[model samples]
Structure formats: structure tokens, C-alpha cells
Target: MTIATTGEADALPEILTERRGAVQWVIFNRPKARNAITPWMEDRLIEICREVDADPAVKALVLTGAAGDKPAFMAGADLSCLQSVKTPEDYTILEDRAETAAMALEAVRVPTIAALAGACVGEGALLAACCDVRIATPSVRFGFPIARTVGNCLSIKNLARLAAILGTARTKEMIFSARLLTADDLAGAGALRGVVPDDDLTERTQELAEELAGLAPLTLWTTREALRRWRDHGLPADGDADLLRLCYLSADYQEGIAAFLEKRRPVWVGQ
Candidate 1:
């Protein structure tokens, strides 16, 4: 269902939300762009998380991309948007919003599930990791491909989130190799709760959401909160800022952006 949100009236909303029984479904709606996130979408997502948290009636939250022949839970952040962020100040602002959005999703009071398909890379992968459970189709391609496509780095918080699910070794290997992890890869790592056929994704997700919705809410919330605190116990207030600057401020980053837009290989040189 189309949600009436504050945005340009002429343009389609990048994010759409629907209520299915006690479950709230949040769909990333920009199918033409493979649902790559823009700053505005991130803001909307944060708002949705807040709304869900405030509503006691909402028992579960499910996030997914719009249906299409080539679906993407989210390809990543929009490159066109990232291209505009050239300075450290701009990058900081961008990361701040993204981190806020991710944290918001992680802190949702209801059980969260990611109904993933196709590309779920970079920021998309990180956000999916924030979900309490993930169910994907065979078409799922998950990982951080920044090393090959963007030449940018993830913040320490994002790394920790991934590491928590995929383990530190696989996480490091994922970034270093720049290879997209398939459904089997994620399922084997215990990151994906289940992998179903592409056609059954929606039905399966709804069934799982309904089951979770029937459980004791306080128990679910407590378990989620406990794990979150355990994962975040030692995280510093300032996390990998220098590393973010090193990559976002580098010449190779600019080259990567240009090459990606131009459909060419990025010639990366450590700056």
C-alpha cells in the first residue's frame, strides 16, 4: 500500500510502508534504481522505526525491496548522492545520517526481519544485519563490494555489526575480496535465518512475522536489547573516523565513483 508521506508530490516516494495484521512491512520503492537508498529514504526509514517503536500494536517489522524482475533489497546508497559528498565534512554528515538510521532500525522494539532478494550490498547489507532475523531468496547477493566499486570504507560500527553476524574472519575476507556473498554463503554463516525460493519470499516472510507476533513481546524485546548491548559494550563513541576520512577523502574514491558511473573498472591506488 502507498503511504502518504512528506515529499515532493510529483515524485514517487522512495519508501513505502504497509500494515499486515500486526506486522508492519517497510518496502524500499525505487525499483528502477534497484532500490539504492538516498538520504531522504534514510530519513524516512528512521521516522518509520520511531513510529513502529511508539506503536504498541505493531508486533513485528519487516523490511523488503519492491517486487520486480530484478529485485534488490537495496543495492546500496545512491552513487549520485555519494558523488556529491567530496569533503570530510560532507562525508561526516552522510555517515551520521546513515548511522542514525541503522541504529534506529536496530533499536526497534518489535522483532525485525529482512526479506531480502537480489543485491544487498554495502549500506544495504549493514542495515539487513541490524535486523533481528533475515530471510532471503536464492537470488540474494549479500556483502560489502566497496573495495571494488566504491573504494570507500565502512565505519567501525558497521564493521562490528557485520562481524557480529558473519564473524570477524569472514567479514574481513568479504571486504578484502570484494566478492558478493550468495544466499548459501550467508545461510552457512548463520546470518540468514532461512533461504526460500524467490516466488515464496513474501508468503514465507509473512508467516514468520505472524509467528513472531504471537510470541511474548517483552521476551522478544528483552532478548534483542540484551544482544545489542553485548555487541555494543566496548564500542567507542568515536569510531573509525580517521579511516572514514582516509578513504572518503582519497583520489581513488573519486576515481571509483567516476569509473562506476562510467561503467568501467576503478583503477585504485592507495593514497
Candidate 2:
């Protein structure tokens, strides 16, 4: 595996960077908090998705940890953004931003891998699950604890994707109980292609990414689009439009935005 790392202080802090051959990487840099997804990172994440989609040189993209050493491949949403969310309205705006990033992950024109390690929780799990492939280490833990942590909802498209990938029973257990599954458990449940020792995770991920990158770009993109279309069939028309509306029209959305910019807890008025 050819590894190339770049540290750009001018680059967005919430997300980091690296590139290998035709494989482009977008690393979630908030390791201290287990790679928590911040609002700034949200925009950066979408931008990276667009960047890869538009760049002809990037045939396969990987979303992974910075050097694959974090305690979490991705932990989840940044809870710091939730305090001012007093009403469902305010909550939806935040959710919309997150869903946009997630949608971009799904819509990437090239093959994508969620090279997961450590804890893949909540939003992180959703992000990984959005990828075309998920590779994990033995130490990885996966779950969506939103039912317990916040009243936030997952977009129907993402919910359907999860159900398709993990199956109804397994998806139900994870969401309903907010249970965290170890790598072995997730593998048995068919959530990941394979699990390796921690040391081999990064190399194996690179191997897979490079392999995909070698394939014909148009073929890969067409395949991804076909799968996406199939998933869309399972979702209702205007589903995403409604999700966007739910967030755009919410009072909580207003508070959440203000609070995020202010770097303080949102004082929700439940407008």
C-alpha cells in the first residue's frame, strides 16, 4: 500500500486529508472526541464528496481515520451541537445538514469504502454504512444509539439503506435497543465484508481501495447509480424533499444554527 499523508492547517480541521494513487481519502480528524461529526465538518464532508465526484483522477474514494489509529473509525454526531435544539423544528435543520453529507456519500460517482476501525457509532455508523463497502478491524464497535441519546430521526433513504445492508431483524435490534455490536458480531450479521487484526486494517483497506481504483471509472459509476436507483425504488417520492422541509421549517433548526455559530448551547424558544 502506498501511503501519502498531507497536513493542511488551512484545510478544514474537522476533516483531514490524504491521497493514494487514484484513491482519495477524507479522514475525520476529531480523534479526541472519537471523530465526532461537527457542523463545519458536515460542509467539508459534502465538499469532499463533490470534489471526488468531479475529479476524473479520483476513481475510488475512502473515508477513514487519520492513519487508522483513532479509538473510533468514526464515533457519531457531535452532541455539542444539540443543546439549543429545543423543538423538533430546530432539530430538523441539524439533521438536514447531516443527511446531506450522508446523501453525498451515497451519491459519490465512484466506488467508495468506509474503512472503519474502532467504534463506529451513530452518525459515524451511518456514514460508514453509506459507503459501497465497509471494512473493519477486530476492535471496531458499531451501533446507532440515537433512540437513547436524542430524539433525532434518520432519513427514510438512509433507514432503508441500513435495513437493506444489515437486514430487518439486525437493523431493528441495533436501532431499537441502541445496542453496540463488536466487529465480530457485526461481521456475523453481515454488516462488513471482513474483519482483520488492527495492524492489517489499514493495509487491507488500501488494497481494496486501489483494486477498485483500477477498475473502469464509468463502469463503477454506472454500477453505483444502478444500486442507488434500486434503493430509491424502496423510498417514497418527495421523501427526501419532505425531510429537507422538516428541517428547513423548524424553530429548532433556527436555534441549532445560531448555537453552532455562537459556539454555545442553543437557547431554544420552541417557536
Candidate 3:
């Protein structure tokens, strides 16, 4: 069943939900923007996560991008939205929404799978990292190119998440390089469960999701929760604000956004 959204008749919802047997699929549908997520989409995603968690019949939750000429799980946050964020407060609000959405998905009771195809960068990559398993096509390109494109920084919690999956050194390199990592790279790092051919992506993801759905739910839930707790064990409750403020409230960040919109190279002057 498709969830209806309020918008122009020809406009598609930013998020779409489909239920097939015991697997629930949540799709990012803004193909025109390379499926860049918006605030509305984040809200919808949180709602879907809650729905999936409350429904015992849903054995697996699969997240993917709607097919397009250029497939993208999610390119990142909508540039238009990011362009509007100018203050540390604005960035904080945005980060909070994103964090809530990610946490909701991570807290789901059943197994979660990310079926990735094309570009999965920035917020997209973070969401993918939240999944219990990621199955991708060879064409997938995943990373946070913020240093080169957005001049923004990831929250400490986000860094921890990536470090947990890819290790501290790899995560630092991924951000520092400002380049998208290939599916093979991620698979080698053990970040992805598997990488399949583009043609076999859907079939392989379905097979894996179904296989996971057949597992003991309690065992899966216990493992997921335990790992999450372990990851958060030593995390600090405060102290990232200065780091975020330094980036978000800088001239360089605005220049980065302007340059990106203008299709020109950003001239970063470390402020």
C-alpha cells in the first residue's frame, strides 16, 4: 500500500512505503533531486520506523531509493534546505531532526537492511550506516563529501557511528579525502553485507531480506540492542557544540553552499 502525500497531482511524495508479505520497504522517491532528503521526508521516515516497530507482522524493513535514470539511495539533504540554514541554531535544529530519524530506524525491533544503488552520501550514508545490514550494487558510491562540497562537519555521535562500522582511521580518511567510496571499498571494510550486480540488486536484496525475516526475532532484537548499547557506552553527553558551531557558523560554509549552487569551485578560507 502507498502512503498518500499532500502535493501537486504530478508531484511524487518524497517518501514511499510498500508492504510485501513480511517485509516493509521504505523508499526515497525524490529522483529529480537524486533523492535528496527533506525535512518532510525525515518526519515520514520516523513515522514509518515507529510503524514498523509496532507491527509484529513486519519481520524485516528494507530501505531503498526509487528507480530513476540515475539511481540514488539518497544523495544527501536537499541543497535548498541546507542553503537556508545559516546559524548554529538552524544547524542544530536540522541535526536534531536527522538524529531523531536515524535513531528511530536504529531502534527498530527487527532486522533492517539498506538496499543501496547509486549515490549514498552525507545524510544518506549515515542512514545506511544505521541499518543492520547493507546490500549494494557495484554502482553504489557512498561517503560524506562535506569537506569539499558543504564545508560542514558531522556530529560526534555520527563520527562514532561511522567509526564503529569502518574504524576510526577509515572514517577519518573517508571524510578527509572528500571522495565517494565504491561499493567494493565499503564491502572490504565490512561495512556492506554484500555487493551484487546492478541487475541482480533487487533480487538479491529481496532474498537476503526474506532470509533475515525467517530468523528468530528475539535473538536479532537482542543482538541489535546489545551492540547499540556497547557503542554508546563511553559516549559523552556534551562538548560537540563548539565543533559544530565552528563549521556551521562560518563564512566558508556559506561560500561552499553558494559555490555548490553556482556550480563553481569553493574557495575555502579557514575562518
Model 3: per-residue Cα lDDT over 1-271, one tens digit each: 3322223211767787888889999988887677899999999999998998789899999998877767789999999888888887798899999999999999988899999999999999999999999999989999998898879899888998999889999999999999899998999899998989877887788889899999999999999999999998887776698888899889999999999999889999997
Model 2 lDDT-worst window of ten: 1-10
Candidate 2's residue-wise lDDT over 133-163, tens digit each?
Answer: 8888877888876544433456676788788
List the candidates' TM-scores in order.
Answer: 0.95, 0.80, 0.95
Runs in model 2 lying further than 4 Å from the true structure: 1-12, 67-70, 237-271
Candidate scoring better on lDDT of 2 and 3:
3
- Which is better, 2 or 3, measured by TM-score? 3
Screening candidate 2 with a backbone cut-off below 3 angstroms (N, C-alpha, C), the clashing residue pairs are 84-266, 89-250, 89-252, 89-253, 90-252, 90-253
Ranking by lDDT: 1, 3, 2
What TM-score quantifies how close candidate 2 is to the native fold? 0.80
In model 1, the worst 10-residue window by lDDT is 1-10
Backbone clash total, candidate 2:
6
Best by lDDT: 1
